[model samples]
Target: MVADDSKMWRTILKDLLSSEGYDVITAEDGLQAYFKIYESCVDVLISDVIMPGLNGYQLCRILKKDPHLKDMPVILLTGSADSVDRFWSMYSGADAYIEKTSSNALDNVKKILKNFKWKSDMPPQDGKNVFGAVLDELLAETTLRAEISELSNHVEDVDYTIQKIRNLLRSLFGIKAFAALMITMSEMILYSSLKDMKKTEEDLLSRLKRPYFPSYHTYRTIDGKEDVEGLNSIYKVISYDGKEEGVLALWRERSFSVREEKLLSIICEEIGGIFKNIIEVNEYRKNAYLDDLTGIANFRAIEGHLEKLWNSGKNFEISIIDIDHFKKVNDSYGHEVGNEVLAGLGKMLREFGEKHDVFVGRFGGEEFMAISEKSNFLTSVMNEFRQMVEKAHFSQSMPTLSISVSAGVARRDDFSSYTEVIEFADGLLYQAKKEGRNKVISYESIG
Candidate 1:
């Protein structure tokens, strides 16, 4: 018996096994898989782990717990090469976890099915076709045995995962067009392989209207409903632990068969889990570059921004800002009040950064920094920031009490590297403080 949401895989496997003269059955999702397994005894169950109502793990657990079906060996299929996914398969009591992308997917299925071949005394005929090419040697078992940490090089962000799925479907199944919608830890991402690129989300969502799948139960009992005419596409909603994760919509000119439906479902489910892990990785990445108090980029992020500028060979004007007599403000009020001042300023700076298309972040203590593409008004931006700080009241303790900031502006042409620009800006900033408390100093004026 084979149970997967992908109709493509289901048809291929069923045909392969049937040709070998083995009676075969198929299911589209876990709900259908459960019924198909219980209806009549089968040799071994090959099921895809991620499914609509009941997932592979859920199905395996339920079967393992049931005394009647406990002896039935189960083989689980996954699309992700992630170790977290491997751990999940192991915990589910599956006899094997086959990665769909591995060249050995079909070979592994044969080996697993043979291991659990029922009480029959005779061996089932080898399912491989006489004309089919021989199975290639396992390539060091990468689809599973490879270290998951090595994924850092492969898994960049949700886009990497999204494009990977598109590539896999294209390479393996000849699926040329599909749309994926996912929301990861940092942002919402949308991708579609449709040629037009102009098709809106409304168009994709419209595809789901009119009717639910012709018959959801057709997946469970392969005998249920015949294929609907002109319906060559399939849509599967990916989720984890009862929460909505993402949706995949795909279409081909040919109508999907029972086998392909099961395979596609399993693929979508595996992608959901992969996306979840990616979200966690991205969150960690975002945290490492974020300031704890100011909610802006930290010094580490500043370095990255400078590296980007250097790589792009772009020139910019920069400003370094310092709060006037900040220590006195902290000493007079309290560190808590000082924090409030910084947070308020950070908020205002973030808005200013967006409005002016500049990079802004706290530079430790009461110092802040900004850099933008060269423009005559760069000086005005810096002075405007200083004036805004001077007029702002940070504390409720003394509503009328205000603070001021000093700034120094420098153009990138005056310096070769970020370190040089920063040094030049810092020198001018101190010169301003020395001359007077509230003042904006230009790099040219210092010389």
Candidate 2:
């Protein structure tokens, strides 16, 4: 029987356990659960804590004292992330504690049920030494994986590092499921050189679009042959608190063994928190390289984007645009209104970039930039924006006040690098401002 205040979770648990051939029962809360299971012959109890009336802990405590239900084997399902809850569950006389958000919740339930049945239903000397070895192996693997997980906390590029760890574990444990590997961090594909992966990347990407995935889900290919290809691939989602950070996919020609499934499930749990930390670190690094004011990507970001494009052999143009008489506006209208003008200009440039297929960023104060691939289109668009800013009103204080921008454009060349292209545009921009404001200067116009 499963008891919880959350009807959705209750349904989900009911479906999962019922699918495993167990006759399942669900209750809305602990109060309803007690009335149904009290003096009832139940083999196992699955309940959520923090429910109305008697909570799971209280229910477990009461049941433990009852002569008939004392050995029923209560399992407390909780959303708690802290280690303290395990102690509390044990104190309440619960046999097992399962976290609600656990990726392998159903699997954990099966393992718990198996152990309970093994101890209670089976007499001593039945399974004997073999059962003892199975239990010992499970415990040993759990403890070792926990230690490795703690060590992975220090890793930055978790996706890449985990490939090595997976290999090590495969060799150490003599694991058979090894075909191809694909690792991703929040839809950012880190490494995907998997066999038969030309279209597999698309498949893996589609999986990430889902709001959630079971910690371990199998994707079997049914290319109707003579026989069934069971569990051709495994997609392991690494997440924390319902937010996902990464996924590790493993492909194999043969079906997975039962032992490998258990091993991979434990590994997924261990790596989820580590990948979460890795993603957090990457976000922090990216944020540090962005401009605080004007919402412009910093020079470093621009360079990175350019480098990627250049490596891909794509044609692109770089332009530097500067607002005319910006310092005067700041001096006259105070920095506040000047800030409003800069913000307005950034928004305008961003819209134009989006509409015209350009990459826009604030190069610095009083200066902004746009990168585009269209040679004939972007130059005209930048010139048009210069004209628009000149005619548009910024504020009531400056109703009749005019704002103008001078731009210098440069196209990708065989001779010049991305930075060199920017420098060339910067020189032409100097020429535009020096000669006259509110004019667009092409590099062809200068030298």
Candidate 3:
């Protein structure tokens, strides 16, 4: 979700997300945005700090107060550099604060989204929605318990640091107080990382039901404190079923300490548990809908998705791609080599299709399908796939092999069933093979 008063900025942001394959929702102001949030689910919220009818700060406060919406990541974009402005943004519950003039806003947005977790359902609200009320309840009961436990342990070390400072101050110069202050600040930084981790875990658990893996690394500052040069600390929540999920990395100018390490470990463990749950859910979904070998949408998944989209009254193009002389290759290279080629081709198609919003999947042995938003681009994407196959370099030890694919693309302006579009595309693909291998033939051309 993008909320800004400037129509130009809103359009620009929306286009950027669209180009990157995201379905975006836009609002002109904070009030409009609050209504949207109430009505829909948004993965991330990007708001301009200064807006009419509930500014970004007020918006953040409202969201953070709401039990149903507080878990959603809110990023505040400001054009201000004043220390007071930064403090206000933070105090208002903004997860991240960025300058509007900074070229890194987009990067920061990406980072926030990558780490964000959204809740699936919310507890019923009673009276006026208060910020952080439900989250405060949930955290106290679950997430905060884990965090507080970790913090309690750190408190002991902080006490020792205080004692050491007192002794140093009396015996040495009066610099002991400053030294203790610095250590206290470092510990606070560690506490913030841990808190963020717990929130991330809660978000993932609420949003996903799949098994996931969690990994973490802690870095210490140059003075052997809790800062790291490249990373404050890194936490990654990965789906074990092979999908990239959430990654949260905080960067500071220094390194970490023993207390920080313990806190990081606990945070990583909590995050990993949540990820594991998501992965498990994904695995069940995958088993029901994915091809075991190619890892593309299985026939069932593609058919279902296509049906849904078709029924939703959206226009789409479907194409069938067949490997040219694939049987002959299998016979010449044997099944083992043929399987290798199939896997290699599958990977290539996946990577190439990423930039084009094309969904490429194995329809069956030696045959594949690619769906694209633009029917015209289907032919070009297939053409590129064919050229890549023709120029591919196989294993050196095995016999040098070359292969090509023939594709047929079909587009529909009118609503049509999935079967109709697929059949049309398949017919075109057959024509490509019949005319000559390695060519893209379209239904329009054939008709």
Candidate 4:
């Protein structure tokens, strides 16, 4: 019986074996193969490792436990050139293991059949059932542990998620190194523990170009033996939202055991959800720092920047701006029109700040703030901004109604604390309003 999910592989193997004067029975999956094995007087079973319902290992374990079928030679075939697959096949009580990609796959299978035929007269093996039972028990324990780890894990960002995954892989497999390559619509990010990211990326991309296996979770291999810390990497493509999103690669000196491979599959299945949650968390964080009314930085975000700049002892200039007679505008027009006016002014200020390499945000009510590195042209920049506001029209519906602003500027060098500078700028703003509205006030004017 030849069991494989792929129709092409089943047909090719069945024809090849039938030509060797052996009647061939084909099954599409492990479950179907098991039932067919019972229905037919099968002498040999050739099955692909990765199949739906029941995998090759599970099928072999079941066959080895049955006294009637335990003596029948079973050959496990896999697309992965990973030596671990051969170990897993033998542990599952298969008589022989063959790589489908091998040039000698046909010769190897024929030789195994010839050898097993000679030993057909011998009695059935006695210890295979015991070993198979032990393998199943070990796999169950590993699966339970992986499930508990997944349930308890909570990650806030992509970096944290990757780190947690790395730690888990290391603990589970004693991996030498681990890496990830994530491709989004806007960017491609690569992270590796080995530090040689350029070389790792080059080798990973090259190996990914190799032929893919025909299994539910296909793994491709480049060579038969372990290469270095990173060259002999085994990677699984992460897919979500109906497309390939990333690659997770792992390297270890020792080959992964059968139980570890199963656990790795479970990890691959859940990683897509982890990445999706991280993206959502980032979007939530970004929105939290943005102003809803102005669609710019909120006061909380501004405070964070101020704290950073003050702690670093960097010299920067701050401008506190207020709209002249803003209450009158709100009284004459409704609050809706006042909101539109605020939003329009915010858009203008944000664009101007961006053009001048300044940081701007809405302070509160009808007030706005701007911060910039201390420069020789600071006073001129403030004057130019005031003049622009005086000449500009804010409301398109009420274009004839003009708006003007008053600003007070202060430098970080003159203040003991950032709060004091804000208070001093607010006082200067009051001074500008006291003398007359629609003017810019600074330390130089008061001095």
RMSD of each: 15.3, 16.0, 26.6, 15.9
Candidate 2 stretches greater than 4 Å from native: 1-286, 395-400, 444-447
Across 390-437, the per-residue lDDT of candidate 1 in tens digits comes to: 888877776876889888888777566878988888888998999986
TM-score of 1: 0.51
Pairs clashing in candidate 4? none
Go through the candidates in order and give each one's C-alpha lDDT: 0.69, 0.69, 0.63, 0.75
Model 4's TM-score against the true structure: 0.46
lDDT of 3 by residue, 1-447 (tens): 899998887997888778877778999988788767666666678899899987999888877765566777888887788888899999998888988788887777776676766654743333224334434544434553364334433332544433432342223222111111011101111112232434434433333345433321122122122322243333333233444334334343345555444444444444434444433544576578767666667788777778787877777788888888878877887887888777777767777777677877788887888887674677767777788888885544464777788899898665347788888888888888888878889866756
Per-model TM against the reference:
0.51, 0.44, 0.46, 0.46
Report the alpha-carbon TM-score of model 2 versus the true structure: 0.44
Report the C-alpha lDDT of model 4 over 1-447, residue by residue, as the tens digit: 899999998988878888898788899998788766766656788999999988999999877766667888888999998888888899999888889999999888878877776223334333435445656755765674565356335646556567677777778777776777655443345667655556655555544433332111112222222336434456777666655556788887767776577667667666766655554564475588768777667889889989999999888888899999999888997787788788888878877887788899899999999898865445678789889888887776787877889999888876889999888888999999998888889877776
| Candidate 2 all-Cα RMSD | 16.0
Candidate scoring better on lDDT of 2 and 4:
4
Highest lDDT against the true fold, candidate: 4
Q: Could you tell me the lDDT of residue 49 within candidate 3?
A: 85
